[model samples]
Target chain A: MKLLEDRIKKDGQVLPGDVLKVDNFLNHQVDPDLMFAMGEEFARLFQDEKITKVLTVESSGIAPAILTGLQLHVPVVFARKHKSLTLVNDLYTSTVYSYTKKVSNEISISKRFLDADDRVLIIDDFLANGQAVMGLIDICEQAQAKIEGVGIVIEKTFQRGHELIAEHGIRLESLAKIAALEDGKVVFEKQNN
Target chain B: MKLLEDRIKKDGQVLPGDVLKVDNFLNHQVDPDLMFAMGEEFARLFQDEKITKVLTVESSGIAPAILTGLQLHVPVVFARKHKSLTLVNDLYTSTVYSYTKKVSNEISISKRFLDADDRVLIIDDFLANGQAVMGLIDICEQAQAKIEGVGIVIEKTFQRGHELIAEHGIRLESLAKIAALEDGKVVFEKQNN
Candidate 1:
């Protein structure tokens, strides 16, 4: 977590509209070592949850989720933003609005991947308003799977994501929690530990 | 590679329109141990290429690419299929046609991540017509990066992907090379080794 916080301080760029760009090593371009470490941390945090599957959204969330799957020795399943013609099975669908992309897209996971018996661990890169994770949670509920925990890499705690997940009585853990970004500087909440 | 081929034979579904679904363990739901094996195999196959970065498109390609990056101890950068407002600078863009989605989309990589001095290895889930890899190759060309090789989890040799990549004079290695899928049964090409 310290490594991620330090890296964010060094290379993360803050644009207007609460955008924190970690493309140099987190979003577009990824640091595998750091990401793997973060994944291990997630596994450690949720070690007792008996997680059966790792779920995430496509694109940005795939990196940490795949690494976490490796650490937990579980299968990683990512919801697709686009519907493929090849995918003809009954899918559990949930709609998520992306403020960054300025579009609302339906995310889906094949029914074959999730079921009532699954203990799902949701993972993602960044948490803003928690809309994406909420969508994932919606899909999990549709499959009747137990939500073991949610792991996020960087969280904007100021965006009401923390309160939303807490209100749902779901456990949430993030590697780096950003309280605010002012004048290209990141503000961190006091370490909960 | 043997493990991958075996898994494909066991779990891969061959559908009409040349669709071979390994989503059970490769695409939609990823088996970490098997994916790690494939990544290690890729590292071994291209170990001498001195690859500085691993590149792929988003969604399905991220799993293997991230694993490959872990084994190689390099950064992994995925091209975004859609432009985001966060992306404000010039990008290395290429248009790729997806038979699965029935859409042609332009994939772009931020110019900040790739450079002329980098040696890039492109990784992907499957190769049917080589459109995705070709699009990645175009981006690499735009960045003026030297391409070490292309790594694919499964290659449908019955398609023109093999020939197209071969014609480009870039080294390509596929874990499972299917010669054909007749009568819902997969036929594998002779292993080059």
Candidate 2:
């Protein structure tokens, strides 16, 4: 977590609208070693929980989810944001509004992949307004799967994401939480004990 | 390679219209153990090459690319299909036509991620018509980076992907190459000694 926070400070760019750009190592251009380290941290954080599967959205979350799945020795089921021809008809679909893209898109996972017997750990790269997390949670609910916990690599603490996850009483662990972006500088939240 | 070929034969679904769906282990729902093995295989295949970086498109390719980067101890840079608010203006972009989705989308990699000094190894899930790989090669060209090779998990030999890749004069390694998909059965191409 310290390593992630340090890397964010070193390379992360702060844009207007509270956007933190971590393309150098986090999202667009991923550092696999750092990703694995983050995965290990998530594994340590959720070691007690009975996590049968790691759930995440496509694109950005796939790297961390795969790494987390490797560390936890669990399967990763990534929800596809765009509907592809390969996708089966039996699926649990949820629509999420992306603040970044300013478009509402449907994210879905096959019913065959998730079920009531599994304990799901939802993972994602950024947790801003919690719309993506909420969509995953909705899918889990539809599948009747148990929500083990949620693991986030970077979170905007100033946003309402943490509050919503807390409202659900789900254990949420974020490696780096940004408190504010003032004058193009990232101010991180004090480490939560 | 045998392990991967076996996996393809076992779990891979041969759908109508030459589609081999291995979403259970390769893409949608990823098996981390198998993914790690595939990554190790990719490392073995490209061990001789001077791979400065591993490149792939986002979503499906991120898992294998991460594993490949882990084995090679290099960073993985995934080209993002969808643009976010945080993406910088300077980028290496290319258009790719998806046969499955029937859509032409632009894939971009931040200019900061790649440079003329970098030797990139492109990794991906499936090599069908080679549109995606071509787009990746285009990005590498724009970045003035040398492409060492293209590593594909599954290659449909019946398709034109292999020929297109060969035309680029880059080494192509596919773990499992299917000669034909006859009557919902996978017929693997015989390995040449």
Candidate 3:
């Protein structure tokens, strides 16, 4: 977590609209060694949770989630943002609104992947407004799967995302917690895990 | 390679219109250990290429690409399929046509991530018609980067993808080469590496 927080401080660009551009290392261009370290941290945090599956959204989350899954020896299931020809019906579906993109996408997972017997740890690249996490939680609830916990690479504490997950009584662990972005600089939340 | 071929034969389902659905292990529900093995295999195949970077498209390709990057100790850059608020200009762009989805996607890589000094190894989940690989190659060419080779998790030899890459004079390595899908079954191409 310290490594992540340090890397974020060094390379993260604070853009307008409270957006922290970590595309240099986290999203668009991924540092696999750093991702492996984060995955190890997540695995260490949730090692005793009996997690059967690791859930995440497509694209950005897949790198961290798959790495975590490798460390945990579990299958990683990524919820698809686009409805492809291969992914048809018999899915656990939920709608997620992206405030940045200003669009809502129907995220889905195959019904065959998650079920009542499964315990899933949801992982994602960032947690801001919590819409994406909530959508994943919605799908988990529909599948009757137990929510073990949620692991995030970066989180904005100033946003309502932390509060929303807290309201659900879910155990949330974010590697780097951002308090605010002021004058093109990142402010980290004190006493972060 | 044998492990992946065995996995495909065991869990891969052949659907109508030549769609081999390996979502259980490859795309939707990913087996991380298997992915790590594939990454090791890929690293062995291209060990001497002096690859400074691993490139792929987002979503499905991220899993294998990240694993490969982890093993090679190189940075992995995934081209963004969607134009987000944070990803502005200064990009190398190309269009990829997905025959399965029947759509064309504008994929872009940040100019900062790739350059002429970098030697890139392109990785993808599937190489069907080679459109996605071709798109990545185009972006690499635009950046004046030297392409080491292309690595694919599964290659449908019956399609034009293999031929396309061959015509480009680029080295191509596929974990599992599917010769054909006959009577709802997958047939492997003879004499596969």
DockQ of each: 0.87, 0.88, 0.92
Error of 1 at B183 (Å): 0.6
lDDT of 2 by residue, B1-193 (tens): 8998888888989899988899999889999999999999999999998899999998789899999999999989998885333454798888899999798888888888899999999999999999999999999998899999999998989899889989989999998889999999999999998
Q: Please, what are the lDDT tens digits per residue for candidate 1 over residues B88-141?
A: 467888889877768888899888889999999999998998899999999998
State residue A73's C-alpha deviation in candidate 2, in Å. Answer: 1.2
The top-ranked prediction according to DockQ is: 3
The models' CA-based lDDT, in order, is 0.90, 0.91, 0.93
TM-score of each: 0.96, 0.96, 0.96
Model 1: how far residue B94 lies from native, Å: 0.9
The residue pairs in collision within model 3 are none
**Residue A134 CA error for candidate 2 (Å)?**
0.3
Q: Tens digits of per-residue lDDT for model 1 on A5-91?
A: 999999999998888989989888999999889989999999999999999998889889988999999999998885323454688
List clashing residue pairs in candidate 1.
Answer: none
